[model samples]
Target: MDELSALAARVWGELAQAVSTRGHPWRTATLATVSPEGLPDARTVVLREWDEREQTLVFFTDARSPKVQHLQHLQHQAQAVLVLWHPGLGWQLRMTVRTEVTFEGLAVTSRWARLKMSPAAQDYLSPLAPGESLQGLSPAGASRPHFAVVHARVLALDWLSLNPEGHRRARLCPPERAAWLQP
Candidate 1:
């Protein structure tokens, strides 16, 4: 492959290796979304899936989640950001990708129902809906019969690596030429 592809591949290798090792404990990333007023919001969530062929990432959250509300308000901006850091590797993925809520599709429900969860984990969903202020500690100890699971899928990642040895900060952008910029 060409230089761009080579660079991306090298970084992807680092990501895969780092993710598989015990060097870094920062596995989960902060997903950031912006509202219409240019306000910022973020939440810490687990890494659900990754597709190498499509170059995408996925995670799950409630449909009525505050982050989902912000997403709905954005309407036209279909992209959301995921900030990941591997301090040990001195690398980060300023991941930019298309975000879509997966729930209505039949296949989606099947995947949801198959999720491995404990009773305590299921307690997060209280049937009372999200964002609704509850009366007491009752909701905190409640559980839904069958919790709804919605996933946010992201595609197309932009990676940046810091080479402290050479004082180099390089960047890789896709679908075009990749260049190293001082960021």
Candidate 2:
């Protein structure tokens, strides 16, 4: 591989490793999207899956969440940015991606099957929608069916590395190009 390809591959390697490495810095990423009102919204989200070959990342969220609503409002042309920072390595990756949201499908069923038995499932079981006001005691629900899966197809990734010796930056767009940028 050439120098640029090698560097891009290394970045993808870190992302793949973060999928199952709980302590990895990229395990939690900041997802930023534009709401229907043209306002920017950002939130921290867990890294559930990653595929280097497909240039894709996956995460789970509540179907009723504002993020979902934002993506849905954009429909087929939904675009978002995912930012990952590694304090230990002094590296940061900002990925531009096209997003797709699935409320029910194999993606949702399979993920739900694995998640339903875990404590994290409680996040989707709330009686009220996300950001709703809490008044009286919470009511118990049998099964909260608000699980949603988001698939992000990475279009380009801007990687920056900070080091005491020097700093480096690159922009990687798979299949065709990877170029170094001024840092």
> Per model, how many backbone clashes are there?
0, 0
Top candidate, metric lDDT: 2
Query: What does candidate 1 score in Cα RMSD to the true structure?
Result: 3.7
- Strongest candidate by TM-score: 2
CA lDDT for candidate 2: 0.90
Clashing pairs in 2: none
Pull out the clashing pairs in model 1.
Answer: none
Per-residue lDDT over 95-158 for candidate 2, one digit per residue giving the tens place of the 0 to 100 score: 9999999999899999999999999998888877788887874678536578999999999889
lDDT of 1 by residue, 1-183 (tens): 976678788766654554445444345778888876778888876665555556655666665577666666756666678888877767777776567665456745664566636543453456655667776637353444323343444345566667756544445645464676666
Candidate 1: Cα lDDT at 14: 57
Score residue 113 of candidate 1 by CA lDDT: 65
- Once fitted onto the true fold, the runs of candidate 2 whose alpha carbons sit more than 4 angstroms away are none
| After superposition, candidate 1 runs with Cα above 4 Å error | 13-26, 119-124, 128-135, 139-156
lDDT of 2 at 35: 96
How far in Å is the alpha carbon of 73 misplaced in model 1? 1.7
